[model samples]
Target chain A: MYEQLDQSIQQLMWDVRKRTLKRMQSAYDVAMKTSYKDLVTTVDKENERFIDDHLRKLDPNAKIVSEEGLGDKVTDLKGPVFIVDPIDGTMNFVMQHRNFAIMIAFFVDGQPVYGYIMDVIEGTLYHGGPGKGVYCNDQRLHAPADNDLHDSLVVLNSGITLNGGHNFREIGLQARGVRMYGSAGIEMIAVITGRVGGYLSYLHPWDLAAGMAMAKELGLSVKAIDEKELDVLSSNLVLVATQQVSRDISELIN
Target chain B: MYEQLDQSIQQLMWDVRKRTLKRMQSAYDVAMKTSYKDLVTTVDKENERFIDDHLRKLDPNAKIVSEEGLGDKVTDLKGPVFIVDPIDGTMNFVMQHRNFAIMIAFFVDGQPVYGYIMDVIEGTLYHGGPGKGVYCNDQRLHAPADNDLHDSLVVLNSGITLNGGHNFREIGLQARGVRMYGSAGIEMIAVITGRVGGYLSYLHPWDLAAGMAMAKELGLSVKAIDEKELDVLSSNLVLVATQQVSRDISELIN
Candidate 1:
């Protein structure tokens, strides 16, 4: 564990979180990044800038990969790198003003060192790493029971499930129940907290980075849906689940 | 308006909310009511008893129709009635210990007087009716902009949507996005808060009553998917949404 780096990162997150709450109480300008579903708010940009400045100071040599284009192009994670999503669920941020999260992951020489997924509204910080163990605030979390696919709830991207992407509709049926919370960070919170058996979504690097680290640290299966290696800088259809559930999903889809 | 009833109910809800939070801090027994999808926990039972006893003292003359069988089995809403769901999302309550709610609705001569839908974890209480107007805690709510179905998100029952029940899949596809949160109370929270344009689910009386009351008061459409008048005492495919969204869903389904 990078003890000093971890502490610095956690402190930065809490500081950023306070500003985010105050910033959210007022209005912010919003613009579509790609589609109406893809939004970028002034708050998102401000938060990214705030975090980027702090991250730069925390690890001067580390390259920062960020969603809002304020950081490096980050073609690879060959060295110390920080991947950040200032607001992981912008649509939910625009519509509900809740369920959005700030996610950050740190990697050293291509190995995850630590990750943070903060539920902004609830002020809950889920942070830790493989050797350090995962935590919800000060509470250490055990690896959730690996329940069978048919016996546990799953979180699916609603669009994919409705459109039958990767036979997600069938996968939804196989689970004990299905939920769609819109925010990947919130969905990942469900997964890491053992609220759901797993999550399946097509996500960008910034969206998947923090969640993937936490899932991996928790000893959950974190993999590409297509059974290929996940390029740390590229988007993919990802599955973060228990071993048994992951196998069930892969078999059903393939 | 039963002004006295309204004040008493709100106070009772706050009291119950405190007790519920305290009760949840300890472990509770969980049992399946019918299937794995259906769960009843000791918290549900204890919460129901607490609320029932309070309701009995608050409105000695009114009938209580509740989910846990702590209520009357009257066939119709013929007089002053209090419809309650001690815990609206028992499955969510069991699995996540959050995203559940305590819901209650009051009707006199089959006309809604007021309703309460409290998001248990968030401690947000949405309570109001037609003449009194709706309030989320101390802030009064205006009718949310009735955006077109294609522009607004729709919340669906994951099971029903995947199974194409009531042509919900098609309806889901037509919306900008779809989300499923599992609990009727939580889903209703999305609707009444104007976070989503609409919500559709197969619901029991207790599940639908409080949400329906709040939605109606907010000037949204609260109706049966079949375009039939709701019975207020029977299970049905319920649609609670902005007027435009409701019409769009009905058109898409038909």
Candidate 2:
């Protein structure tokens, strides 16, 4: 179950979260990471450093793979590993000053053990993994009720949907509604909490790492858009949703 | 400019808002007003009644047209008229319990004078019209920067998008992103606050009445999809956006 490990991770996450909130209150520099569409701020780098130091202290033997390049060269997940995104929605943070999140995933021998997705402004921590089950803050969250695509609200990525990438527009039409909150972590948390039925995006390892872990525990399916399984080491066009929703979406899109 | 009327209406709105918040805290009844898609709650009825009574008290001669059948039945906007949607985004209120708003528009001799759209939960009020510049809460809102169709977020109605109404799929693809917040008032507010570039929906008079007033003050263009001027008394495929965005979207779709 890794209950003990979950508890430990939760504690570490809260500490990191508090640090992040404090940093956000102060002015920080911003820079483009890939394009103007992709951004990083001083807060992201500082938070990454803070989390990296803490993780190193928490489990010296564990390898850390993080978004900010402050961790090890993580080519394989053979040993205990922590995948981290210091600030998951940097664009939202830079623009809306809300909807951003901090994420961390704990894995052992290539299997997810625990995950945490913390909404920085809302002060929510969605954390857990398979066997232990998922949770939002202190409340134990039940898996979302199964609903057909036509009866559920789903989250979609803006660029992907607009570009017709992965047939997102067709899938979006089937859902009761579509929300674009601009944060993968926040969107996945919505799926786990049943606020939305699913979230689809082309995401990097760090973007989906924590969310995928928690979602799996909630009996939600997390997989590649194509008929392939996901590997933690790479990026994929991912779908996180209830089993029926995943099946419905794939059947329509594929 | 109706400066004195704006002040008086603002006071009345705050009172109604306070009452609505208190009522929301207590248990309330819900019933379908039309189909399963349309809903009315004790809260909606109560809020409508409260606003209607207050508006009557404010101006006995003014004709009030409201969504919940609590106001006057006037055919034309010949005198001082108030067009109100006591609770815009009723479905959102019924399901998500948030993202809904209270909307009101004041007209004098068939010309829009002042408007208000208040997000109850966030406690932010967006109000203004015509010669009066729009304001979000206490701060004045400048007109959003002009962007092309491919550079801005647009909000759409789920039913319309899914049904392929008004070439929604093609229009959605042209925008930088699409968001569905389930509330017309909130979506319009997003446009006013520069959170999104535009919002298009097939809306009744009560849905667009309030937003249309304030949007015009911010130099945004509100029009029908068929290149016709909005009647504001009839349902139409409405487009609300900056001048450039509106032109780009219309050119691409029409």
Candidate 3:
């Protein structure tokens, strides 16, 4: 039922990728947010504006929620909403010149309907939601086999791992190893592809929305560590992984 | 004087890349070493043998030291010594199927003469030593600006960071951010390219040899964290970074 919408969103994401990649090649301006570690750039603002314009034109009544303040002031996802993080991992983009992504999710009546996460430099897109199977580009992705937490490789955020919050250090010890790529979209995609068994991080709405939307469809479980359903408008300590691994992490963290 | 030898090693590395990339596409055998977190594969051994054979043929009198147990046992870095980690980041190779590298170093009279670290999947090679400047693929890499420890992004090993050894936790807290890519070769390349300012971890002779050689050519300091000269034949806690940042890390850790 949402095929056309998914395709349209996917096409728009590619266009965003093209524009973002071009901007990455040239020099750009950067501004700090919250702390020195948190970053935003001119490319981020420009990409948000571009996606917002395209999404508004695609569905005039849809509410757009984005990172760079170019979208509607979104309080709740009660109606059609496009949640966007125009440049996820801006720190990576500004510093590493790679490993960043563009993310978007379309929700209707507070239900995730379509999601997209594009690793811009690598040109790989992880997209889908609900009945549509998840995909990395043209290839369909199956639900990953449920590996136990002890047997899995995990992507961890640097702060949480060091802080020892949520018993994360114990979890790190049990896991095969931990990788830190500093991009939520790429980390989620790693789980979807079975490259890593799980990923855990604290994230804002735009950062978590799109990846989580697709994560669920791939037969992975994504949730707030507090055991409540994720609230679309609020930040959450999120974990996405195979069902068994997610359960294992929840037990440890909780 | 080493131009011919350097060119030959570079050509051999490309050949290794081709063989390894093709093998990565197919199934291969993996064996655990020390622990499940440590892995070795048939492909690793095969690549090592391949490189060893070529190196022997290129300079028949040179003594070879390799990770895969295919090279001679040498007590010291006397005469012509070739150190090879045919596949650094073997865990990455087995788990992520990427981020692994082919690292090689050539030393004569215990002096580093040439070094090569090939990020096989990305097809970017970081190679050179001493009088020759470092190059990432074809582009010459200049010495990275001596950013302070607080101003830099650092790549750290997951085990060491969480273990809180070498004052690593303090370093992580102080840096702009910390990253863990699981490949020392790629991490060192990140330093040479200025994508990251420093990398530190415990490493074996094969793992440390190549990258340290290239690092010195880029005007980066590579040293034993204990403020002693490295024992080339034994594992050492190592740090590779810009001069000032290395000193800063040294002071903090010491």
Worst 10 residues of 3 chain A by lDDT: A161-170
Which run of 10 residues does model 1 chain A get worst, by summed lDDT? Answer: A157-166
Task: Please identify model 3 stretches exceeding 4 Å from their true place.
Answer: none
lDDT of 1: 0.87
DockQ, every prediction:
0.75, 0.36, 0.75
Report candidate 2's fraction of native contacts.
Answer: 0.31
Q: Could you tell me the lDDT of residue B248 within candidate 1?
A: 89
Candidate 1 vs candidate 2: which has greater lDDT? Answer: 1
List model 2 lDDT by residue over B1-254, tens digit each.
46877898888778778988888788988787875557789888888888888888878999999898988877888989998888887776765667789998998888889999999877889999998888887899888888777667678776766655677777777765567777888988888776778788888888898889988988898999898777877788899898888888787664
Per residue, candidate 3 scores C-alpha lDDT tens digits across B107-212 of 9888898899999998988899999888888888878889988878899878977777778888888888888888888887888887888898899999898888
lDDT of 2 by residue, A1-254 (tens): 45666777788778878887787788899897876667899888988998888888778999999998999999999989999999997877865567789999999999988889998888889988878778789899887888778767788886766555677778887676777777888888778887778788889888888888888888898999886879878988888988889999988774
- A1-254 per-residue lDDT for model 3 (tens digits): 76777888899999999998788788899999998888989999999999999998888999998988999998878879999999998988987888899999999988888889999999999998888778889999878888988778988878988777787877887899988888888887788888889898898888888887788888898888898988878988988888989988988885
Candidate 2 residue pairs in backbone clash: none
Clashes of 3: 0
Q: Candidate 2, residue A133: CA error in Å? A: 5.3
Assess the local accuracy of residue B11 in candidate 2 as a C-alpha lDDT between 0 and 100. 81
For candidate 2, give the lDDT of residue B41.
91
Interface RMSD of each: 1.2, 3.2, 1.0
Error of 1 at A91 (Å): 0.3
Candidate 2 residue A36 C-alpha distance from true site, Å: 4.9
